[model samples]
Target: MRVPVQKQERYIAIRNVTILSVVANSLLTIVKITFGIIGNSHALIADGIHSFSSLAVDAMVLLAAKYSILPPDTRHPYGHGRYETLVTLAAGLLLIVMAIGLFSEAYEQLVGHKSPSEPTSIVLIIAFAAIIIKEAIYHYTVYIANQVNSPMLVANAWHHRSDALSSSIVVISVLGYMAGYLWVDAVATIIIASMIAYVGFEECLPAINKLIDTSINKDKRIKIKEIAESVNGVFFMHKLRTRKMGINILVDMHIVVAPRISISEAYKIAETVRHNLLDEMEEVVDVLVHIKPENTMNSLDLPQRNEITSRLQEQSIEVVEKIEKITLHYVDGKLLLDIDLPLNIIQNNNQARFISQQFADFAVNDPDIYAINTYYHGTVYDSPKVFQIDELHDFIQDKN
Candidate 1:
C-alpha cells in the first residue's frame, strides 16, 4: 500500500535533515580529533568524542523516522511510533556512557598532574570552527523536528546542541592554556563531560515516561474534559485517560447520556464527541469513548427485557399479547416503562386509560417499577401511518 501524504512528507523532512546532520558531524569529528592530537589539546579531543556521539544519534534518528511512519498492523495495533522513543532512549544511554568514560580519563590526567601540551593556533581555529558548525546543525535539526513533530528528532537536535556546548568549553580551555593556566584544560574537559551526562539524563527522562504510558499534564486533562462536556447530549464525562505515543496522544474516556435514548442515538453522540475532540486537538490521534446511561448505578441490577417479560407473564397480564413494544427507563433507582399496543383491545379513551391503570396496579406491589405509560396505537383511515391515542387526546384537549 502507498504511504499517506502527511507521513510521506514528515519522513522526507526528517531524512533530509538527519542526513545533513550526519555529514556535518562526520567532518567535524575527523577534523577535531586529528587536529587536537597534532596540537596536543586534550580538551579538543574530548570535544571530538562528543561529535562522534552526535553521529551515532543521527544514525538512530534516520532509522527511526523510516520505520515509525509505517501503518499499524495486527502485531502492532498502535503503529510503530514507540520505535522512535526506544531509539531516543538508547541514544541517551550511549551519551551518558561516553560522558562517564571521558570524565574518568580527564580525572586521571588531573590527578597525575600531567602537564598538557600547549595547543597551537590551529587547534583553537578548529575548536571555533566546530562550535560554529555544530550550532548551525542544531538550529537546522530542531527546525525540522518541530515541523515534523517528532520527539526523536528533538532529542537528536539537543544532542547536536550538547556537542556545540562542549566545543565552546574546549575553546575556553584552549585559550586559558595559552594564557599559562595549566589546570583549566583538564577541568574544562571534566566540565564538558558533566554537561554531556546532564543532557543524556534529560533526554532519557521523557523517553522513559512515554515508555511507561504516563498520563498527560493537568492542563491538557482539564482541556479535554471541557471539550467533551461541550458536546450536546453528553450529560458528563469521567475516567479520562491519556498517554503519549511518539508525538501523538491517545485518549480514552467515559461519557454519560440520557437513560432512555436509543442505542443508535447514544452511538451518534459518542461519535460526535470523538470527532469534536479530534478536530479540536491536533495532537490527539485516537479517542475511545464509552457511553453510559445517566442512571447507570440505579440500572446496574435491574431486570432486563427477558426477566421483565417473564415477570409480567407471571402476573397474567392478558394485554401482553397485543403489546407491540416495551421500553424500560431507569431513573432515581426506579423503573419507568412505556408499553405500546393496538387500539382494538379498547373501545374508547376511558377503556384505554383503564387498561393503562390495570398495568400500573399490577406493578404497584413491585417497588422496582415506578410507573407504566400505555400507548394505544391505531391506523388512520386517510393515512398509512399509526397515531398514538395519548397524542390524539392531548391534541383534542389543546383544541378545547
Candidate 2:
C-alpha cells in the first residue's frame, strides 16, 4: 500500500532537518577545531571534539530516517520504524561515552595541578560566536524534531544544545584562567561533562522503555478508551494495549458489541474505532481491533472455532457440505450459531424448514448451542446475491 500523506510529510521533514544538522555540525566542527589549535585552548579543542561527535549522530539520524520510512515487508511486517529507536539508543550511548572521556580528562587536569594556558582574543571570539551559532542550531533542530515527532531527532537536538552550553562554559573558563583562577577551566569541563551525561541518560531511558514495548501513559490510554467507546455500535472496550514504534504508536484493543448485530456490522464498528483513532490522535500508525459480543466478556469456557466447526461437521455431513460460513456468537454462557448456506441446495420451503429443524434438533441435544440462524445466498451463476435474514424469512413463508 502507498504510504499516507502525513507519513510522507514526516519523512521529508526528518530528512530536511537531518541534512540541516549535518551542515551545521560540519561547519561548527571545522571552526572550533581550527581555532582551538591556533589559539592553544584545550577547552575549545574539547568542545570541538564534542561537535565532531555530533556529526556522527547526525549521520546516524539520517540513516535511521531513511530506513525507518520504508513500507512494511514480509521480513519486518511492522515496518522499519524501530531502526530510529535503535539509532537513538546508539546516540545516547555515544553521548555517555564522550561524557566519561571528558570527565576523565578534566579530573586529570584538576588533580595534576597543571596551570591553564590563557586563550587568546581570537579563541574567545570564536568560542562566543560558536555559542550563539550552536544555540541557534539547537532551537532549529528541536523545532523540526517536534514537528516530525522523532525521538532520534530530539536526542540530536539536545546534543547540539549541550555543545552550545559547553561553548558557553569554555568562554567563562578562558576568561577565568586569564584572571588567575587556573582551576576554573577544569571545573567548567566537569560541569559540562555532567550535563552531557545527564542528557545522555535522559535519552537512553526513553529509548530503552520503547525497546521493551512499554505502554503509553495512563492519560493517553484513557483517551483511547474514550475514543473507542464513542463509536456507535461499541458497547464498551477493554484489553487495550499500546506501544511506541519510533515516532508512531501501535494499538490493540478488544471492543464489545451487541450479540445480535450482523458480523458485517460488528466489523464496521471496529473499523470506525480504528479510523477515529487515526484521525483524532497524532502518531498512531495502526490499530488492531478484536470484536467481542458483550455477553462473552465475562465468560471463560468457550469453544474454539475449529472445535465448533468439527462438531458441526460431525453432527451433520450435509451442513458441512452446504454451509459457506459459520459464525459462533457466545452470549450469556450460551452459543448462537449463524450459518450461511447456498440457496440452490434448498429448492423449496419444505427443504429449508427441514434443514432448519435438523439444525435446531442438533442444538437441542448440544448444551452449548442456545440458538441457530441460517442465511441463504443464490448460486453464483443464478443470482450472485445473498438475501437478508428478513428477506429469506419472507421468501420461506411465501413458499409455505
Q: For each candidate, what TM-score against the reference? A: 0.88, 0.79
Instruction: Compute the lDDT for candidate 1.
Output: 0.81
Query: For model 2, what is the alpha-carbon lDDT of residue 171?
Result: 89
Q: Per-residue CA lDDT of candidate 1, range 38-134, in tens?
A: 9888767877877887787888888888998889889978778888999889888876887787677678778988776677888879988877887
- Assess each prediction's global lDDT (C-alpha) against the native: 0.81, 0.83
Candidate whose lDDT is highest: 2
Candidate 2 lDDT over residue span 286-378, tens digit each: 899999877775446878789888888887547567788888888888888988888777666666777877888888898888888877787
Worst 10 residues of 2 by lDDT: 388-397
